[model samples]
Target: MASGNVSSVTEFILLGLTEQPELQLPLFFIFLGVYVITMLGNLGLLILIGLNPHLHTPMYFFLFNLSFVDLCYSSAITPRMLISFVKENVISYGECMTQLYFFCFFVIDECYLLTAMAIDRYVAICKPLLYRVTMSNQMCFMLIMGTYMMGSSGAIAHTVCMLRLTFCDGNIIDHFMCDGPPLFQLSCTSTNVNKVVVFTIVGINVLVSSVTIFISYTSIISTILQISSTKGRSKAFSTCSFHIIAVSLFFGSAAFMYLKPSSTGSVNQDKVSTVFYTIMGPMMNPFIYSLRNKDVHVALHKALKKRMFF
Candidate 1:
């Protein structure tokens, strides 16, 4: 029906999570609360890390960046996603592209950062005597730089590939965001290259990161078992468990979202996975780490005491 393609397209309409009127309001409030907590939790961790001298180790350094990434990751998508809940989610081409770029950026960034943290944990657990040397200031800086670089490259790749597509059909994105699958579905042009690039890049990332995590955790478990005392082994397991949970949640949802068969009757399932990684993942990270970490608890109490005294 429409002859003009993405070139002539000025805007796109985002069909929110569902069309049901009854579900819309409830979903809005739920995600609103989630976003609020995401902000507070992540921002609080960032500030706490900055203030607490005790948390200035390689472990906390990774966490500081993790918090920062989660904050940005949540911010990049949540605000725009929230708009879909209340009103017409009409996003300009530029805005949509921008959102897509940053969304890809943050997600990819989190992937590598989590891998880096796993390595950090590996060094801490498996090679504690050399932890300082292995995860030095310079090394941490480099790892972080590489993490962001990958994010930038992945985002650029996806966005550039997407830009090449010609959208002549209804410019309506079925999901809340400008995700790859829905956008590819709307293209009048062939998306073979896009598919190859998508799977190649995402698969490489997931494979490498997940393999690294698996190896690190396996070694960590072995090392913990070698501990002589029950308390020592228990403590080691306790410390690593939080990171394991975060990794499983993030990577599991991400795999479900990206690696699934792109067939009919699967849009809702994809959206659910997307929402889990994009919405719930970031929100859960800060809580997962802080709630279990004694250092964060001590730091919070000390900060509160200082505030009370002042």
Candidate 2:
């Protein structure tokens, strides 16, 4: 046991989604396309929000932050995964840890941010009279700050705990990225404490965010139902529909990936689930918000027309 605890591996080889040689190039092109779309879509949205004075509101403010987070989040994992497709998929121990930390940070940030967005929607829809006062500029800034702080604290906690564990097991990481569960499997030291910390932090983040969203939407739905006109109700629902879809896709895929018991046979399934949230989610968010949003479409058209005219 002591021998096993002695450090021998300095780097780990990532198996990267599949061991099939034939599939590697195809998956590479697929994810490269996804990454390209993720960058363009999110960046375009950010630029649109920044330039359009009409979009300078509390909702787009939160969206600006969301797009930034999604950009950073996807960059943290996707670039490295892309590299794995073409090169020898080896990552240094320190590099892997850094990747894990940022991945956790952005993911947790997103969870809380989505909750904040839900709260924003609730205040706007359910308490329109108080929306201006309740979601003032200072208040929105503080909420965004708090989300980052919570995410940083959680990431720090997980990374610090993981650092204490010694990894002397074989140097192959089964998944494409250096995630908690797969990394834990490589640790030769007792991982009970690490597991406990992970479960506690993740459970709290997911639970609190999920509950907040649930309560906010409950109020939002009730308020919408009270509207006397069908058109009014539809209008109200449309306002939150994009957010609802984004939240459902993010949480559903994440819950499927992290909440399940770790099993050796499920690595491929885990990879697929991870791709949904980390890769596909970011790619889809800008489309989800912009395609359904009239304001975004209007702003985009005005911007394009201005560019063409200039």
Q: What lDDT score belongs to each candidate, Candidate 1 first?
A: 0.90, 0.91
Instruction: Give TM-scores for every candidate, taking all chains together and pairing residue i with residue i.
Output: 0.97, 0.96
For every candidate in turn, the CA RMSD to the true structure comes to 1.6, 2.0
lDDT by residue for model 2 (11-97), tens: 899988887888889989999999999999999999999999999889999999999999999999998898778877899989999
Q: Return the TM-score for candidate 1, rounded to 2 decimals.
A: 0.97
Provide the global lDDT of candidate 1 against the true structure.
Answer: 0.90
RMSD in Å for candidate 2, one decimal?
Answer: 2.0
Clashing pairs in 2: none
How big is the positional error of residue 64 in model 1, measured in Å on the Cα after superposition? 0.8
